[model samples]
Target chain A: MSRRPEPVQVVKERRDAALDTLVGGLPYLAFLGIRFERRGDELTAVLPFRDENIGNPLLPALHGGVTAAFLETAAVVELAWSQLWPQMEGGAGAAAPGVRPPLPRTIDFTVDFLRSGLPRDAYARAVVVRQGRRYASVRVEGWQDNRARLFAQASGHFMMPDLSAGPGAAFADDEAMDPAPPASEPR
Target chain B: MSDDQYLRIAQQFIEALPHARVLGLRLLSVSPGHAEIELPWAAHLVGDPATGVLHGGAVSTLMDTCGGAAVMAHPAANAGAATLDLRIDYMRAATPGQAVRARAECLRVTRSVAFVRATASDDDVERPVALMQGAFTLHAPRLAGEAT
Candidate 1:
């Protein structure tokens, strides 16, 4: 007889799949070679270094705009993951793994350059300062080599998607019809 | 510097930045305390594939670079400068397939800082896609015989 999959295992798989889909949906993120690593509900964004990402050839530093983009991506992805976590854990109102909620729209973002972003693989983590039904505020810190020595930090205000309209209604125009799975298999 | 000389220096300055090349940012005009740059639409820069809208990050990059160029062009801030803090507000999605232009002005320059404001617009100049304000650290030129 075949063994049935445990309920906890099924939930975990669904959550993982949804997270992948969410990140895969953003084409610009793919272009920048940004990936996410999830540990339980926490997520860390990684930006693999490429020559094209260099701004100052003399310093060989990562582009300041690219660094800001990385931080913003981290904040957006973290917010989405956090929103999906409760639904997955409850395992009741969960949408299918392929069907994701609309990505939040950024209202304003502010980035502070603490140091030059070294030309190397960089990492970032975002903290949600406030999350409400209509608005959310997130802060992100990016570092290379050392987590304590942040090269840059950013704060963003986002206008949350209005989910009350219906499933996928808010993002009907923006959602990618065919979100290709990431090229690299998840480790 | 003559207008032609200033233009050449600005173009060279922009070309030196690798990220500007990747984004296809072209210098349109530059004068003391003012600069304008343009980014032509490309497939790789699309943020929303379904809507064909350019990504906000692309716009941010353009505005940031334009702001820096403005700071660099300022008579009082001809030396190197780095962004200290930048804030951007998105007003609406950019019209797809249209080249976006960013114009920035250096509003003020203090001893060690320069203030800049910028706006990104498409063909419709009346409504801008985004607005930005930033402060940049003004680096003093190296003096003769200074340690490298």
Candidate 2:
């Protein structure tokens, strides 16, 4: 993958503004208190725990569904901010300072859970392993210990549309998306 | 003779399932030994071009639901079992706008857990869009009804 032309340095004002716009409409992560922090080459998202986020009542650990959602959200958001991919609804200008015009869709994902994330804020960082105009793959690491102890992780394959006809800056006009519904099993 | 008492709960169970509400999966039918779920088209939920085909994640969830229900119908004491591992292989894409259906068989269900295999298809069950196999733990006691 010829490194897609590196983007210009995202200035503070521009960066924060873009992030705020991108993060606002995501109902799922918002409910979980997921927030983003960007340094060079790396993107981070945090999940601040809530009482209702627990399922097993006994262990008081973050529910598995919540953990998986955190991992998926972080991976997709990382793709958005990293410029390797764009948010499904967001484009180059409003979400990331220098991201390319069109966004990539998550194609495939695999997640592994190492430890239960107890009730508290959980931190995650994602890195782009390979990137191309057509497809981009990323790996996301989520941790509760603050140092990457392998609490949860996921990797996804994504595809994007051609900018000439795809959803453009006008995407900003739509409201933020609600958190996607839970997994619907057969039965 | 009760032909299929578990049939009603089978369908209702999917509706009451918290995750199903969260994912937007709709229940189509739940009969004596069969069930089906539908995933309406949503760009974010799709993986391949089957624009209307159910998202792979949605398909996985449906498969689990079917497996869980199979265990629940078996007269097992425990009706709870967490998915330890789930694996799916995507074959073909469902038609855009058409709803995909999954038919699963309770291949083998034991006292501690059950194993199931399912196939997803657009128009033909023989020609499946995807195939899934999974194991579900029967958390309920050893008795739900007759052992399967």
TM-score per model over all chains? 0.87, 0.57
Candidate 2 Cα lDDT to native: 0.56
Model 1: fraction of the reference interface contacts it also forms: 0.52
In terms of lDDT, the poorest run of 10 residues in model 1 chain B is B138-147
The true-versus-predicted C-alpha distance at residue A172 of model 2, in Å, is 24
Summarize candidate 2's per-residue lDDT along B12-51 as a digit string, tens digits.
5555655555555565655433456665555444432312
lDDT of 2 at B123: 51
Please give, for residues B6-64, the per-residue lDDT of candidate 1 as tens digits: 78888988889998888889999998889999999988887756567787888888888
Candidate 1 backbone collisions, by pair = none
Q: Calculate model 1's interface RMSD in Å.
A: 6.4
Runs of candidate 1 with Cα error greater than 4 angstroms are A1-11, A171-187, B1-5, B140-148
**TM-score of model 1 vs. true structure:** 0.87
Best-fitting candidate, scored by TM-score: 1
Best by lDDT: 1
Candidate 2 at residue A19, lDDT? Answer: 65
